[model samples]
Target: MSATAKKGAAKKDGANQPFIYRHYDQEKLRDALRKMYLIRQFEEGAEESYMRGLIHGTMHLSIGQEASAVGICLGLTDEDQITSTHRGHGHCIAKGADVSRMFAEFFGKITGYCRGRGGSMHIADVSTGNLGANGIVGGGLPIAVGAALTAKKMKTGNVVVCFFGDGANNEGAFHEALNMAAIWKLPVIFVCENNGYGMSTSVARATAVPNIADRASAYAMPGVIVDGNVVSDVAEAMHEATERARNGEGPTLIECKTYRYRGHSKSDRNRYRTKEEIEEWMTERDPIEAFESQLMEFGVIDQKGIEDIRESVRKEIEAGIEFAKESPMPEVANLEKYVYTEQA
Candidate 1:
């Protein structure tokens, strides 16, 4: 069948997908696809490095949550800020963090985002409005609130997006931060990338509420539930939340129901979840696959276009890995440089 006929048939059969975006331009959609593919490839590289014993510290992989990361960040501008969690490579990359430096950070080279001190969990680049990814669960919440407060006080017209796991939502910091933001009308977006587990503990076993967004009602703000696997759905939700924040309404709590294809961390084995469940998510409901299908149905790109994007992303990641490998390690004499700030 011809490409036009195929597209027409898909639409007739309702294959165009329900989350059709009206605001996002064609270039933006293509860029979103590229960014998501880049995050996937970068995580794959990190896994390869981890298996080879090249990386020292442990790393958390968000292999299945790229849609949530890219979707939300697509709505944010360069001036907007974000806070990230341990599994924050996607978040950092979405916020325009340099991949080469990120790989260097993983390699513990001096050229990394944290100058080789923070490793994977603690990567931070304030220049791109990514404050940092915190090692502690729920740690980024208060930091995000603080950034929002700063933006509010200075009238910078910038919004802060905080990316935390489902596990972090139960912490006291989560509640306190949301309450404060609501009361002060802080321009912040609290995004819950609920990947179904908190380091082996299922959300059903830990969280009391059925949905994490339900907690947002306590703060007297809007609570949005997004299909974490759908990039367009996430982007639209973030756009609405950002608009509310920019209008000085208050903070928003968004729960994205996503899943992690791999284990929680490097040491984790397939103990809690089943193999069938993993296969289902990875094969059938994979975010990248779903997004590609939708893009194709929308006539945004053909199969050749998809392949080209993937090839380009693969080369970019390979270059980043080479950059990290050739970078110099931190000098012992400069170990304490970033530890303590000198009095100005």
Candidate 2:
């Protein structure tokens, strides 16, 4: 597909309800908000099915971090690139991956993305400009760094955004990649979605610094900490950082403070955190609700418009499930077809 196939229309208002946008336009705000809502509904649908045994492999849902993905994606162009972590459905969608094919993969259908070979963690989709989602904790950072290096070397005026969790900050690869990108002044954005935990271990136990962005100082770059729960803040920071990269600047580390409403995976028993913590995050900091309220207040989009958008997303998800269910599975004879880089 062409780079502009799924290209987003430029937005200028950056405003939404309850509060107006200081930097972003209303259209961009609406687009990001809409994408975030689609992500929420899509993940919730996956959760409902995963628990019912329709999904075979482990599924990681980023229910509370919609703002991080959408906000960041809003700042990027189709020519720019992104690399995502294990829990990456939101990234894929925000970057314009096919929702139907994603659900088909989740359902293990032959028509699925990856042709039913790769499951949740390995969904790569180039047409939409989403490189792929990494199963390893820090695998994507280096790949993004390499992509950035190439962009800088080729003078494409494009940037690469690397999305990972706070847990990945501890990985040696993460630090190494940042160091390289810093020195090279690569057009990259290292976005750390710090939801207070690395798998089950809280961020407090994982790091000494109060904020992950503070580490950017060590690399001689700007480190920004934004309220990940608020879409406005995330969009503002990402837009500026993106422009910074395009203007021949180094990378930026954006630490988005958010939360995950679900457990680490479908198998998790939900015992790592207190009930109060979970409930507080969901009730007070839910990104979708927060942004929806904002949009409503700003009168950018009415409640009915938002509801209609959500309903459309929900129906699309259901159609994907149906398409996956009716589709065929991978043939036994072709089991090794996609396992290796080369074909027979």
The alpha-carbon RMSD values of the candidates against the true structure, listed in the order shown, are: 4.3, 6.3
The count of residue-pair clashes in candidate 2 stands at 12
* lDDT, residue 36, model 1: 92
Q: Identify the candidate with maximal lDDT.
A: 1
Tell me the deviation in Å of residue 50 in model 2. 1.4
Q: What is the C-alpha lDDT profile of model 1 across 1-344, one tens digit per residue?
A: 13224333545665344444467777888889999999999999989988888787799999989999999999788799999999999999999988999999999998898889999999888889999999999999999999999999999999999999999989999999999999999999999999999998999999999889999998999889887888877887888899999999999999898999888888899799999999988997788988898888778999999999999999999999999999999999987897678889
Which tens-of-lDDT digit does each residue in 1-344 have in candidate 2? 11112111112233322222655677877777778878888888787878789888898899999988988887677788999988999999999877788888888888877888778888867777788899999999999999999999899999999999999999999889999999988999999999888889999999978889989999988999887777767776787788888898889999998899888987788788999999988887688887787677666788888878788877888887788778888888988785668845
lDDT of 1: 0.89
**Candidate 2 residue runs with Cα over 4 Å from true position:** 1-25, 340-344
> Evaluated with TM-score, which candidate comes out highest?
1
